[model samples]
Target: GIQVEQSPPDLILQEGANSTLRCNFSDSVNNLQWFHQNPWGQLINLFYIPSGTKQNGRLSATTVATERYSLLYISSSQTTDSGVYFCAVGGATGTYKYIFGTGTRLKVLA
Candidate 1:
């Protein structure tokens, strides 16, 4: 079985600040995605990096499959970024089920 854990379960940041979120998995995963759950409860897909690194706007993510860990970087944070960030991964050996990290709750103060 594969397990997912997210660090800094809660975070508080001032506008324009930067933050890094982390996710650790117990096993290798072929499918990995980072998502941000907005204040309205909408899950926005931030990245789908099963390996390597990618960036989008003020956000970036890196997944080291060999290390069984992934990281999401948020730069120049904004109040709009206040929400819950999650990492979801699949392809856990013989199972097709996807597992989601506990989530990292972020609050950006303006």
Candidate 2:
């Protein structure tokens, strides 16, 4: 089994401002994914980086499996980006389970 924790807990930003979110896990994970849940409850997969880094438009992610942590970066934040960002981790253990972090709530104002 794995346990996940997210920092800051919440965030508020003005439009165009950038921010970084972090996720920490207690156990080794075979798969890691970052998701953004929009205001309307639509879940968007932002990244699936088990290691290294990845970028898509104004969003990017980096994972350090060895250190048991992951990072999500948002650049040029927009009002539409306001939502709950989650980090879900899947363990390699026999049970094959996925543990999710509490989530980071982001608010971007105009």
Candidate 3:
């Protein structure tokens, strides 16, 4: 079994601030993703960064599989971005499933 973790368990920011969140895993994995869980408890996949880096608008992510870690960055944060961010990892263990991190809670104030 693999263990996943998200740093800075909680975050509070102004509408325009910037932040970087991190995820650390204890074992090798075939897949890894970053997600945003909104107030309504909906999970939105942000990145499928099994490796390398990706950027979409003000959000970006990087996964270093060799190092067993990933990072999610947010620029000019917004209220819409206020939510719980999570890192989930999956492996080829005969079943398709994801082990999610505890999550990083972000609050973007107006």
Candidate 3 structure quality by residue, lDDT tens digits, 18-79: 99999999888889999999999999999998899999999999999999999999999999
Error of 1 at 94 (Å): 3.5
Estimate the TM-score of every prediction: 0.97, 0.96, 0.94
Note the Cα lDDT for every prediction shown. Answer: 0.95, 0.93, 0.94
Which whole-number lDDT from 0 to 100 does residue 76 have in model 2? 98
Candidate 2, 1-110: lDDT as tens digits: 58899976999999999999999999888899999999999999999998999999999999999999999999999999999999999986756777899999999999
Which of 1 and 2 is ahead in TM-score?
Answer: 1
Residue range with the least summed lDDT across 10 consecutive positions in model 2:
91-100
Instruction: Give residue 18's lDDT in candidate 3 (0 to 100).
Output: 99
Q: Check candidate 2 and list the clashing pairs.
A: none
lDDT of 1 by residue, 1-110 (tens): 78999999999999999999999999989999999999999999999999999999999999999999999999999999999999999975778899999999999999
Give the winner by TM-score: 1 or 3: 1
Q: List the residue pairs that clash in candidate 3.
A: none
Judged by whole-model lDDT over C-alpha atoms, candidate 1 comes out at: 0.95
Best model number under lDDT: 1
Q: Which of candidates 1 and 3 reaches a greater lDDT?
A: 1
How far out, in Å, is residue 62 in model 2? Answer: 0.2
Tell me the spans in candidate 2 whose CA falls farther than 4 Å from its real position: none
